[model samples]
Target: MKTPFIVLEGLEGAGKSTVLQVITQWLEQRGIDYLTVREPGGTPLAESLRELIKKDWDERVSPEAELLVMYAARVQLVNEVIKPALAQGRWVIGDRHDLSSQAYQGGGRQLSKNMLAQLSDMTLQGFKPDLTLYLDIEPAVGLARASARGALDRIEREALGFFERTRARYQELAAADPSIKTIDAEQTPEQVKAHVLAVLEAQWPS
Candidate 1:
């Protein structure tokens, strides 16, 4: 049987990194062989794309260009890293995935879901994660947490409305998809961690 592909997603400072540590620890305790990778990365070419996409450029980068570049990196990583690992029976834990594009580009950039779906079909075919943990937070709260970490990246510097749109899309999508479990990230870290672990444990018990 194909191994599972699990993904964590959220707005900036929704504490995805902290959630990742929880997952890795859980996997290690169970002696599960797993590989962790971040979107727009996970391969040499993809990593470069990650930098290009995240860095500030003097020229205005079109939404179409941004979307395409993101897909390119995802394609490379999916083909090279994720697919291979799953084929060999290792669980793949992703920091972000296609859902991110669906929210960020399709929502924040105001691109149509149809357009995003077409791109997803062309690049990813039908492959998708078995489970997704979506940490939901208010944009302002999340952004404040993000900014506290220091310098804001290109996407991080977007106006508040952009993230508001993004968060709305995320909630809409999560509500429609049963495979996605939403955690209230505005709560204390312990509460958020408990919610995440509860979902994970219930989903895949030892």
Candidate 2:
């Protein structure tokens, strides 16, 4: 049986990681064969790139540079991690994927959508999530949850307005694609997990 490819996407503090953990446990209980990984840092090379990208943000870093680096990391991750795992019939759960670039770079940075699409076409070769669970939350609420966690990183430190733009972009993508399911993340963790499980059951009912 071919493994299902699942990707979890959302803005910072939208409970992406927590939901990931819950889904992993659910899969484990079902004895589902799977592997979990995250974008921008899945492979060793990608992790190095991740560090570079996350290190103190530079106002000098051009939007193009940001986009290139993200795709570069993604290319490496696909070649080294995602492709191989799926080829072996292991379901792969990604913490974040290409939609992130669309939200953060194309939307947040206000880059040209044409350029972004062209780059994605050239690099990703049409790889996409079979199911994408998007945890939707208000920018202020999400940022407050993030702030309570700890000191913000370079990307995390971006203004609330930036996250608002990112969140809106996520909604637009979910609206455009039926494969993407939006889940309200303002609820408790257990409630959010239940919503995700229901989505998976509906999509992959046996």
Locate the minimum summed-lDDT window of 10 residues in model 2.
54-63
Q: Please give the lDDT score at residue 102 for candidate 2.
A: 96
Give the alpha carbon lDDT tens digit for every residue of 103-196 in model 1. 9999999999999999999999988999999999999999999999999999999999999999999999999999999999999989988898
After TM-score superposition, what is the CA distance of residue 186 in candidate 2 from its true location, in Å?
Answer: 0.5
User: What is the lDDT for 58 in model 1?
Assistant: 98
Q: Once superposed on the true structure, which residue ranges of model 2 sit more than 4 Å away at CA?
A: 57-59
Top candidate, metric TM-score: 1
lDDT of 1 at 200: 85
lDDT of 2 by residue, 36-127 (tens): 98878888889999998888854667779878999999989888888998999889999998999999998888888899899999998898
Judge candidate 2 at residue 19 and give its lDDT.
91
**Poorest 10 consecutive residues of model 1 by lDDT?**
1-10
Any residue pairs clashing in model 1, and if so which? none
